[model samples]
Target chain A: MIELKNVTKQYPGQPHPAVDSLTLTVPEGEICVLVGPSGCGKSTTLRMINRMIEPSAGSITINGQSVMNNDPDHLRMGIGYVIQQIGLLPHRTIAENIAIVPRLYKWPKEKIVRRVDELLVMMGLDPEKTRSKYPSQLSGGQMQRVGVARAMAVDPPIMLMDEPFGAVDPIARTHLQDEFLRLQKEIRKTIVFVTHDINEAIKMGDKIAIFGEGKLVQFGTPEEVLTNPANEFVENFIGYDRIVKKLFLYQVQEAYRPAVCRLRPEEIGNALSKMLAEKAEVAFVLNEADKPCGYLTREELEQEETARDADGLQKLAARRSKAFVQTTTPLPDALSVMLEYDAEYVGVLKNGLLEGVMSFKDIRRHVYRREGE
Target chain B: MKMSWERFQIALFEKAPEAVLTHLLIVVITVALAILISVPLGVLLTRPRYRKFGVVALNILNILNAIPGMAVIALALPILGLGIKPAVVALLFQSLLPIVRNTIAGLLEVSADVKEAAAGMGMNQRQILLEVEMPLAMPIILSGIRTSTVYVVSVGTLAALIGAGGLGNMIIGGLALFMPEYLIVGAGLGAIMSIFFDRALSYLEYKITPPGVRAN
Candidate 1:
């Protein structure tokens, strides 16, 4: 855990403090995002934790010891730092860059090499191809990966990131964010991430600290901040589209209605009867193992001349081409899939078993109810 | 008198071998002194506090460059009067501008991102300078050194004016006596020496450049 108590930073000639009596605590193995507009001291607060910018007053501790007592270099080595422009050493090979902290600590040559290769593999790059290449030789996204790999070289428990994904294009930025999120799931380092993009904070942060004019205005989980903003500043900063943004915080299973009126493949007459009795437009068709097969709709049942026809139900039932979303998939993504496929309903599967179903109406109702609350 | 290839060969290989040695020695010492003085001075000039001083110092060196080589030798003659000593000092001064200027330029040109990275990774000030800044600045520094090497070799010929021995002695004698063989021997050997050193340093520059930074 990293904790800052009443931290303040004032530049020599500036009229006002850059960061003022800021206090924050990042729990072990959780990401705390520091977010605000430009000149809000978000970057200043991050730099102080690593002693890149020394605080004018206040105490910063990692785990339990005050950082002021530790040597700056020693403190920094144990805390991984990444910046907006990834600063990979151009003169060094990728392997050498990743091995910097290890070499500084004088790890065995074989061990450093092993660690470097392991990190390369973990970052999803081909180790053999990338080990010898230099920073300039790699693409921007690859360089950013190498930057993160280098920071993780020592496996420092605390990682300080200052808009690390800000330099990449939108598509590459999203890829990097996803890759880092996956990496963090396994490593679970205490991370203090700084970003101006509120949406990124929502996506990546377990807790968000909102800064305004060098003072932290509010700090809470993404849902708490979005649903119950601290004040007018946060509400405006989160913007008018916050309702839609809140959807990203929810998963498909969280709001999905469990599958009902399900029928076996051979129960065509029962499927039609269930649809009529439930006053539902469609009934789910399930195979013998109880997995979703397709949907038998009222329109399809009426279009068919008779339920007893040999291939009647099979021919009338819509193909099982409706998109399948995992239960863990976020609602916004699930919603997009619905729109993209022109789907009225999507199957939500958990471990290959149809746990529930989601439709546009259900999503709208859930979102409206949440907003009302 | 007509030029004779045999006499020229004799002058180059046997008769004036010491003069050739003296020419090579002068070029070596002068270039070495230039490197020793200018490289550190260049690095110091790059420091933020000293940057303004660097501009003033470079301006003075630029003024010195504008002066003719013979005039510098003549100016040195009054203070240190004669022989290889005065000529060496003059050539050393003459080579300073390129080496010092280029060194400062090279160090300044290193990307700020690379330096910030080195610091962020926990490298101390000295380590960042020696390990990161120096290696990145090397190719440009080497190019500067190459320029100085060529200048030193060609300019060493002027040493003969101060009663210093080199191929210049033969050229001066050949001109006085109207002997084309002596002029051909001296000019030919000097040209070869300059080209040889320039090419060798150019190759060194290519070798020392970091592979990642290579334009290719």
Candidate 2:
């Protein structure tokens, strides 16, 4: 959805252009990352997308329209922008921070509130718990999440995040990346992310753009770039231990869940019988959103079958995390996600529909493929 | 020559106090005015369009600072005349060099990561200046202020020669009087004022400069 044609950026008195004559295209709904050492102009290229820095030469188009003629204010509104410092306007509250772009675009108050609430839930944050806090009051992770929330606030089709998680500590950074990857699956915005850290670029990006000395070294999917680099710079840029890096992408992110024959608030007896007949260990108790509010394990069902008040059974319906993902996410990211929440799996929400499993079998296939490749 | 206790106390209070107070006022005003002009000027000097002129302006200010205070007063007498105005002008001239020079250095030294973050937000030059650069520059610039204030306070006594009536007047008067006490009072007060400005500015230095910006 975003395309660059022969872009070049030359700072005055500099020996060479910061972004050399370049042409590239970032496909719709993909996470494209630009990465290089300092002064290589990976950042310049990313900035050029939003016109944060005007290209010295060539053309850039978003959604098939050239950015040169496009009004920057309007163009920026259509593309989300994030920064390393999590620039949430320290003066503003979290809710206000998330509401900035929408307010700028004249989105109605009701719509803004609705969008905020929805994002807060999807990002796994309690809006009531954290929405009123300022950026300074938040933990580094919380502030980073708020930054993403603010970027996603307007539901822009394209997002430009320049090392968005760079300022946070490593543990927080990993968690933020996982949460963002999950969020991206649901929102599907075309994103151009920038970072100097190669591991981060490989971990979070669908495709990676490598740079050296203000020139494009290579642009390709992680596997292609790792396996067959475009040039010597690209190969060196990928660095050694690349095979180890490639193996991280094989995550057991998706899985087919047990058929969820759930019980209504009133039908405890029937639900218990179904659980016993199926020899099921657990089953979901869904709420209005068709989301699991809680789970009923076999032990609880058995106890209810003996001498239980329906009320007691409902009490035992604990919010256990049985909801899990489909096989879309690469294994390493999926493993990272599982590691994040201390969960074995996460429910992959895509296209507003539940997809089947991402399990060890899927990851094993990739690992086995690695042995051959 | 044994000194009486009562006589010494009276001498200390009467002769020493005026010089100290006058010295304090001269130094304070000079440094304050220097900060007022230089901080803003220094900030302006570092802008991209003005950067090339930075070396030029800095050289001129350094030369101005190098001139002796008495020479500055002598030069100013025709244009500014004999008064506290010349004292202030001299102190102001001495005070500005460090404030501007340090400000430019401090502002330019901000990390590229932080600068890039500011630029990515779609904030224009003014926003970056006030919000990002200035706040970060406060500490280093304050050090310059501290250095200049100490220097300005030391030179403030020079105002006495031009009849500007600072602590310098007491020393100069004491010198003429051949009353050693008067000389002690003037010289002692100048030293005290210098120490005070240095300590106060250092305290402010701690408060304004964020941790990790510099070494202690």
Tell me, what's the RMSD of every candidate?
Answer: 2.4, 9.4
Error of 1 at B166 (Å): 1.7
Give the runs in model 2 whose Cα sits over 4 Å from its true position. Answer: A10-21, A27-29, A35-41, A63-66, A69-80, A83-157, A165-173, A195-203, A206-373, B1-25, B74-80, B184-216
Task: For candidate 1, list the clashing residue pairs, or say none.
Answer: none
Tell me, by TM-score, which candidate is best. Answer: 1
Each model's DockQ score? 0.74, 0.13
Cα lDDT tens digits for candidate 1, A1-373:
9899999999999999999999999999999999999999999999888888899999999998999998888888888888888888788899999998898888999999999999999998999999999988998889888999999999999999999999888999999999899889999999999999999999999999999999999999998899899999999999999889999989887788885667677776566677888877766767779877666657767676666452656554445545668989989989888887666777788898777778888889988888777
- Model 2 agreement with the true structure over A64-133: per-residue lDDT tens digits: 8998887665666677888887766554567876876777677899999888888777767889987777
**DockQ result, candidate 1:** 0.74
Deviation (Å) of B128 in candidate 2: 1.5
**Where does candidate 2 chain A have its weakest 10-residue lDDT segment?**
A251-260
Write the residue-wise lDDT of candidate 2 on B1-216 in tens digits: 344556446547876676666677777788788888998889888888888999999999999988987788777777788888877886787789999999999889866655554454444567667866787788889889889887877777778877788677777876785655656667776787778878987898787654334354
Clashes of 1: 0
The CA-based lDDT of model 2 is what?
0.74
On DockQ, the candidate that comes out on top is 1
